[model samples]
Target: MLKPNTLALTVVLALLTALGPLSTDMYLPALPAIAQDLTASAAQTQLTLSLFLFGFAAGQFFYGPISDRVGRKPVLLFGLALFTLASLGCTLAPNIESLIAARFLQALGASGPIVIGRAIVRDLYEGARAGKELSRMASIMGVVPAIAPVLGGLIAPWGGWRMNFVAALLFGAGLATVVALRLPESLARKSAQTLSFLSILRSFRSLLGHRGYRVYVMLSLLAYGGLFAFISGSSFVLQTVYGLGPMAFALSFSFVVVGYIGGTFLAQRLVGPHGLDGTIRIGVACLALGGSLMVVLVASGVASFLAVVGPMALYCMGVGLTMPQAMASALMPFPDRAGTASSLLGICQMSFAAILGIVLGQNLDGSALPLPLTIAATGLMALAVFGLTGRARRG
Candidate 1:
């Protein structure tokens, strides 16, 4: 057996964490195809993504507390089952509306693994060690984004867009099987009493009351805002505006993913030397710098592919560095309530990203101006928040 606290365990946890991107990123290459085949408007097509993020955000409130009362493994398994079934629903969806509904369902299931995985990390590690572990896991999970879009792009031509969902179905089912056999329950101390609505509220309220938690959560939320703007808008911008095909678009996406992977790698090393808050400050600087450059480049009528993707890669690197440290720092003080804390952090992050993405989608002109503008605005705001909040307890 791959014992807990081993690299094997981290890999498994990373896979569990990967359920989110595998579902969303894998389908991105097929988006234009899905829109055409389903005869949906751009906004309607984008709803599939936005609604999934909303469902992902909303579902975490349930999973986090329940996993605290119950254990991680069972909740995760149940979620995987639902995710598998929902993937099938997406594969068989006849219209855009149906696909949108299925995506929401899929997201609800996907939420369980992500929140539980973060809680699991908190269960086993703390402080800088926890940040390192999260960075390692993120580095591993980064592969999914790099690969999923390319794989989906390859699959799109052969079996069309439905095939992308087929891959998601297989992945969910396979992951569920792995969890059932190999993954051990990570929650060391489960709440003895069942969770009441009032108790859940109290848990959330307590997390919200903490100044450090609020700062870290806002940091994460704003970082994600910039990232999701790229995610929600990039496919259309690259494929439609730039006139790239599926494979080419996927390649460009992977290039940006490379930067994120690099950031995660750097974060693992930097956390020990820089401390969590220090590392976060470094990352936020990158976020602001890269995002501003993108805005400048795009606004100056330099809409070359490099102009967009180049700056994006740098912004993504900042995301990679910022997210793990923020998450670990936020959860460090709440070891017992890691599940709930993780859920609240996720709820704020995803909900804000979903809203920002929808707004960006609605404003998408034929130019790439909106994407960089959104990125720069959010990135600068994240920097401002981190600066104003001052240094959090260095992990």
Candidate 2:
């Protein structure tokens, strides 16, 4: 059993970690409204999301190294403050281009909490214990995606799409207050690393050169690539291909959330007994199975909604199972460079996902083939990379 304060701290960390997903998911239902209201084309409106991801990936490179030199608390506070201000900018933007720019800044600010939160977990724990804590955090944060779209849909009728930004602003403000008042400085000893280009380059090079870190980060990155592929293609596959209504599609999407929650629960229970590598292997197997099943089903001319969503739910579960362990393993070898490690890990995940999203968006062909094929390909790549690199190191 955990203490009350410990539980509260976990919840706070989870919320801090959840800011990115909440920002993205909560605003999804309003995309059409945003485009229509701002007189923007679909591609231009979509740039808001793409730019946000770009900013998110870029911001982590800076935040990680800076947090290592400074402290987690200050960086987190600065991020939350920036996120709040940027959310306000998003809410007040008079045109689509301005909204796109504001969204980019908002994602840049949001990246701080995410990268720092993972580093904070490393500060408190290590190895499988860190994996367990991260699994717990993932379990809690899983609820954000489940609720965000519904909340956005409900609010959009009353106040239009801009209200979504207002909600995000309030969330950022409240979280900032809680963090400012309660969160402790987890980095007990700060790194002597400076904020120079050469220093950052050296730090990144060091992390990238570590074979174990590279393997684990690649595993996580490929897993997220599959997930982002699903996210990018699901709406089209479900609504456009399978003819599901918006409400039905939303409900169907919840299955992935449920599957993720289940996977995290399983990870929390299993990580201690099986260890990080064992847990990750199980996750990879599940991911491969899910992706493979999707490909087979789609290729066999199964056009049912379950054919698409069922395998996706399984893929999401694999993501939940894989992420905590892989993240823990990736950062385990670099205690001194936890912030930098976390940031690089984040950059790879977001960058790959963003690229996958762009590719999937551009290749929509009115069939279920593209989405499932992408998922399967990514899963296979992740498994192959892990087996080759991870096994060689173990041997």
Q: Report, for every candidate in turn, its global Cα lDDT versus the true structure.
A: 0.91, 0.86
Q: In candidate 2, what are the lDDT values of residues 271-339, reduced to their tens digit? A: 989988888888988789899999999999996899988988888898899988999999998889899
Q: Lowest summed lDDT over 10 consecutive residues: which window, candidate 2?
A: 1-10
- lDDT tens digits, residues 1-395, model 1? 55656988898889888999888898898888888999998899999999999999988988989998899899999999999999999999999989999999999999999999999999989799999999999999999999999999999999998998888888889988888998878788898756888888888998898988999999999988899899889999988888888899999999999999999999998999889988998899989998999989888887578888999999999999999999998999998888999999999999999999999999987878999999999889989998887745432
Model 2 accuracy (lDDT, Cα):
0.86
Q: Where does model 1 exceed 4 Å of error?
A: 391-395
Number of the top-ranking candidate, with TM-score as the measure: 1
Candidate 1: Cα lDDT at 291: 98
lDDT of 1: 0.91
